[model samples]
Target: MRSLERHRDVAAYALGVLNEADAFRFEDHLMECPLCAARVTEFGPVSRQLMLYRRATPRAVHPLTGPGPRLLDRLLAEVALRRRAGRRRARYAVAASVVLAVAGPALAVLAGGGAGQPVRVEATDARSGVWARVTAEDRVWGGEVELRVKDAAGPRPCRLVAVGRDGTEETVTNWATPGRDARPHTLRGGTALHPDDVLRYEVRATNGETLVTLPGA
Candidate 1:
């Protein structure tokens, strides 16, 4: 029951191929249309799965590069339709989430630490491919967190979220790797909190999956 233009836009938007202007417009529309929003959500992960399948097929080079015309669209649309009849539903490429609308820069220098030394900590995720390091200067009231992710993000978008002691999550940055290769990319976010004000750091998939969390002190 959707128009062809609507379908095309939905497909393009999901694949991250729509031009900036078009994408911005569609995103505005997404805030209003639950159906379109739902469809876009499924395409990212489905595309990643398809990309993996193509790579394993042994004859695919850059197969499924764009979700606009790939098999991902058909599969997700079918699923979305069934769900509507039943149930369902950025990266260095940044989120338009209200929580991050006023976030700080990607990196900030640490200072304070009582004697000009910043506090530092490290933690790794269960997958073992991702880890986070934190450094905060007491008097500066902010810190820098770095994430080194390996072979864990390429098929879908991943986010580094900085959680404050008060439970507010500010997005540090978002990234999606190219193809099935997760060659260890690093993400840095400068948070606006005192060294001790940070409660934890989280690495999550755009789908609301918490990939990992590093406790802060």
Candidate 2:
């Protein structure tokens, strides 16, 4: 069993993939096994040279093995199609994740606010931008403030910052990028505010200098 394990380690060691513990174990076995020692010695020089020449090199051209024009054209077309499909899939995935991330908050805000409420602003797409509605609520003094905003267009960069009249501020929690669909955003936080102090919320898109500021609190 020990010999078998050591033999298995030989290939991994030769490829320089074994960790220190496995290398130590292999060395211990090599001290007592002459056949394994000889095998390691024979491969060691070749392995060292291979490691030394680790840089990748371009494939060398061979006259006899050169691909025919038709084969080359077909392969190129296949490669292009695969690359395009990969990009499309990546975009779809990003759109899906963004929608899922913001769907909950958007629904919550829509439910609490009236269906026809103008407080919620929806983005046309994720690549577009969104901002929450900033309004004065009775619970502001007790730190329960309700803010309605728009969802992000897509997986674009965005941030929400809220500032109170007294200079106290807090950020929205669990906020993420929006999906491809246009949706309203709602954020609620428990931060004490002065009775006369106005709260302000702003959404800034990071990709561009587009800024959306909500009405005063």
Candidate 3:
């Protein structure tokens, strides 16, 4: 995202309206931009304020007497609207993910070469009890790697890595999974590894700890 676009998203980001991918991108930006971080911090108190407003009982006062309660109600309405917008965005995001899941493979194969068939690779992490299945088609430039991960070690953030035959590591993407009671999460990324020149692909935490590996990667 461009600098100005990033700046403009602070409010939707604060309201939690961004999609998972966009939200993660904003957070990665927050780590480096103190200004944006500060804005998020300031916006943090909004929920508390809304809660306080909801708790306040309206005193029986005439319309001519005071507008304070009415103003507070307007503020409450705006907050509710923001929340609704966030929910709508989330629903749209889920729909888009489904569309991609169904359409992405055909598109990838078509992009690679209409005749190339897609391949599936299933992997497991015995130590952490995590598992993944990759559906991808190799291309000369770089190929699309789409897969879902299950049973993560914890809810912390992680990155998917592609390791080539010569041991070159490329970060395909980064994502987060629930710490517990987690459902399978889908992840999609493009790897620079040509199908013929790869060893294995891995999922790693931000700290560089390997989480899971795909065999014949």
TM agreement with the true structure for every prediction: 0.43, 0.33, 0.47
- The local lDDT score (0 to 100) that residue 30 gets in candidate 1 is 60
Report residue 28 deviation for candidate 1 (angstroms): 17
Q: Tell me how far the alpha carbon of residue 1 in candidate 3 is from the true structure, in angstroms, after superposition.
A: 21
Tens-digit lDDT string for candidate 1 (1-217) = 2455665687776655788777666655665555665566456444444433543454655654554566777777765664453222122212333335556566454422333345666666766356555555443224554556664444555566778889876665555433356565555445555557778777776567887787766
Query: Cα miss at 183, model 3 (Å)?
Result: 1.1
RMSD of 2: 26.7
The full ranking of all candidates by TM-score, starting with the best, is 3, 1, 2
Q: Give the CA lDDT, 0 to 100, for residue 194 in model 2.
A: 25
lDDT string, candidate 2, 148-211, tens digits:
5565355333444556676765433223344453566554443334223445555654333445
Worst 10 residues of 3 by lDDT: 108-117
Note the Cα lDDT for every prediction shown: 0.57, 0.48, 0.63
lDDT of 3 by residue, 1-217 (tens): 9877887777677655799888778766665565775565455345334323333435564434555558878878876775676578667766866888888676532122222445567778788777887777754345567768886456555567778889887656555454563578776666556555667778776567777888643
Best by lDDT: 3
